[model samples]
Every structure is written in structure tokens, then in C-alpha cells.
Target: MTSLLSVTDLSRSPDLEEVSFTVERGEVVCVVGPPGNGGATLMECLAGTGEPDAGHIELLGVTVGPGDRRPPGLGAALRGEALPARMKVAEAMRLLSRLYGTRGLPGRLVDLLDLEPLLPKRFGRLTDGQRRRVMIGLALVGNPELVLLDDPTAGLGEGSRRRIEQAVDEVRAAYGGVCVVLDDLAQAERLADRVVLLRAGRVLAEGTPTRLIKLLGSTYVMGVPPHLRVDGLRDVRVLRGAAATYLYGSRPALEAAIQDLSPMSGDRVWSIRTPTLRDAYLTLSAVPEPAALEA
Candidate 1:
């Protein structure tokens, strides 16, 4: 199969360092790295929004050498005021569609994003979730062969999140493109075909989420809902929505929760490890930064 995007000996300046990766046609390549490690910069470079100090960026098999190249429709990504706050949802999308000569940008996007009824609402009147969906639709409207998404599901409720996840899948399936999404590991696992672990702007380990978790050993062969048994833990403190409570037990909260809800509660056994993307991420970027947590 032909590779849609490839970066050989791809290195960025003093900050990004040496980087290399590839995305074949119809594949999702997620670049996962700890915060403050230049993941955002990579997106900017790949999307032609920012210049990389040095590196070769290939898009659709065409070489984009040094300095960001404004690939056909990439210019719109850097437009100021991502969405027109004063414009009605329908009106704004229509304008963008016309500008790009791509009709149905708004009406079809509304359905894809579950925003059919929201199209009538002015941008300012929409809720945060509504706004997010609209913005995402516009971002994808350019028919980009490569999409860079930062926290795609941020600020949305669980139901909305599932929808966003499904939308992402559809985008890849229909567009035959590569979408680089940045988010917690859980989100990555849900959307990515492969994971690239990075640290301080360098690739550390790259593989499927499950393989990385195992390579990480007991460090993160763990995690679950707020309340679950954690392997090799005497106790755990779960901090959710600002209130911190300690779950003290001989096992992880997941194991305990399982036993508590078991059909044979009287003879029940243990817990569960949901294996989220966040779990894998922390393991790849773990540095015992307790002091930073307080900061």
C-alpha cells in the first residue's frame, strides 16, 4: 500500500529534536507524548500552520521540505477566529462552504455532528458542547487529507464524547486520511490504530496500547473508574471534580467494586482494570513528579 504521509529523518529544531514516522492511506497514527514535550508543535508543523526549525514533512506522498507549506486547503486551519461568533451556525458553515466551493458543508456536518437542530442557533447562543461540534465540523470541512486535532473531545459530556469518537471514525473511514489526535490515553485508545510514545521530544517506544502497557510492566497494568482495586496498592486516593477521598483496602478499588456487585456477592472474588489510554500514557511519561503535582 502507498504511504499517504512519511517523515524520514524528520527532526525539528532545538525543541522538537529528531522525529520520524509515517501514515499510510486510510490509517490513524496518533502521536502520544507527555505534555510540554512539543506534541502541539508537531501538529502545527504537520498541518502547515507553523514552521519546524528543520525537518521534511511529506503530505500525500509530496515532499514538504522545511518551513510549513500551505498545502491546498491547509490555510484555513490557521484562520483567526476559528468560527464566527456573530454568525448563525448555518450561515457560517455556508460561508465557509462557498469560500471553498464545497457545498453541503454545514447541513451534512450538522447531521454528522448531531447538530441538526443547533444549526439555527447563533454561535454565541450555543452551549460549550454545541460550539465544540460546530468548530470540529468546520475544521474537517476543508477536506484535509491529514487532520490535526487537539483534545477532540474536550469540554463535552459523555454522550457527546461518544458521538465525537464515532465522528472521528467516520472521518477516517470516508476520507481515507490520517488524523493525529492529541488527548489522554483513553481517548487515544478509542481513536488510534497505533501509539507513539514520546519524551522530551524524542520517540521512546511505539506500539499498540496493549503492548506498551505490558512493556511498562506493573507501573500501569492498572487503572479503572474512580473507584476500583489497584494492583499492588495498599490504598488509593481518588480525586474527581475537586473532592479527594481515599479508598483504603487490601486490593484495588476495581476488584472491590467487582466483588461488591457480583451476582454471587457472598462468594465473589476480585476487581477490574479498564486499561484506559491515560493509564498507558502515565506509564510512558512517568517520572515520579509528586512535587510537580502540587505545583
Candidate 2:
């Protein structure tokens, strides 16, 4: 019942206005916001990576210092930067051995990250997925109470992304700690128990993903089901209040839908977007539809 991280009246002016949230132990809170809207800054503040101009952060029942953006040392290193490319994977990990003051059980790390067969490989030799796993292993090695991941699957392939997501779930289950994932709705939905939508640095809404969908009046999605074809229409009336967007390839169809349906100039008419994580991402972060934008 104890709160792990509490932000009371937190404000990072010129950016984050006033922000506040409590991340209890064992909760995965996903924060989604527009680009350049301070989502990362908020995550850094919560993760002790950056300070808030005005706010108190209490972590694990203790008050932590203001945000520190000092040059990244261990985290960056584990992020797979700064290491000598030729260095053996084991050697790269061992470099931190002295700093951590523990001969980290490399074998265990390998096991936990499923890198046993990859231990002897050099940093330059591993595939993209293997490298990602290494960075993740290093980041979570300390076993902190609250873990923050910023765009954890930004560049990886679909298969690699799937692995990273599974790892996130494993970490949370293993630690029973709060994890705040900072990513677009695509990545966050995989791990979030609840999502907080931010706008101009302030929380616009907070609830479970399903609740957010309902709030946005999103369409029912069943994961890549067969496509629906609305034959030859100048316009088709959109289901009242559903948030779909017009997208590529269906231009002719969308035009037809619009032609057949009577649309008020002021009515907000959104076309269906391509089916992808980004579509869900857009829908996931949509602002409350204004009466004017709807047209």
C-alpha cells in the first residue's frame, strides 16, 4: 500500500507546467505525449535523470535529489556506446566489473538475457537484437525499484522488439517494482497497466488503455482482422464519434465515403489511417475532439 514514487505539484516551467502522479510499487505507468512535449523530461525527472524546477520526488520511501543530467556514465556505457568495438562482449561487461565493485555474474546476466551463446562474441560481431539485449541487461543489472525505458523499441525489427517487450514484462514480474515506460502508444501498450496522456507538460488523462480507447471513442480492433470494403460511395457516414483517419491506397474509397455522406463543413471528418502501431499511437494520443476540428 506504500507509494514508491510521489510527485506533488511538480512543475518544470517553460516546459512541464504543473505535474503530479504517484507510482506505487508494481505498477507500470505509461506516459504518452506529443513530440517535443517533454514526455522524456518527465520520465527523466521521475528516474532521477533530470530535476524538476519545482516538485518533490520521493522514491522507495526516500526523498531523492533533484534531477541530475550529468554526463551519463554507466547507463550510456551499457546503452552500447563508448565501448571499444573490438572488445569482446565479455570484456565490455567486465569493464564495469571494477566500477560496480562486484564481479557481476556474467554467466547469470547471459542467462537472464538469453545471451549464453553470445558471450564470447565481440561487440562488433553481434547482431542488432543481441546488442539491444546487452544494453537492456546492463540497464537492469542494478535491480532498482523503479525502471524507466525511453523508446525501448525505437529501431529494432519486429522480432527484436517483441523480445525487448517480453524482457520488460519479465523484469517487472521479477522485481515487483514500478516501471514507467516512455514511448509512443505502440511500445507502451505492450507493457503498461495504465497510461497517462500528457499535453504541454501536464497530464491530460490517465486510465487503463481500454479506458482511454473508450474515452477517445476508438473503433473496435481485433489485431489485423480481414479488411472491410465499403463499395463505391461518394460518402459514407462515419460511425458517430468514432476516431478513424483517411489513409493511403484507400483514397478512392475514402473519397467515395465522403461523397455519399452529407458532411457539414464544420464537422470533423477524419479518414482511416494505415493499420500499424503508429495508427494506434495516433489514436492513443488524440486530444479531445473539438467541435470545430471535427469539421
Off by over 4 Å in 2: 67-87, 92-112, 122-129, 217-259, 262-295
Per-residue lDDT of 121 in model 2: 82
Best prediction by TM-score: 1
Task: Please tell me which predicted candidate would have the highest lDDT against the true structure.
Answer: 1
* Candidate 1 local lDDT, 45-136, one digit each (tens): 77666677766777776778555454664322321234566789878777777776786454554666887887788888887777777777
Candidate 2 lDDT, tens digit per residue, 228-290?
Answer: 333343323222124433232344555545444434223546445434434433543443631
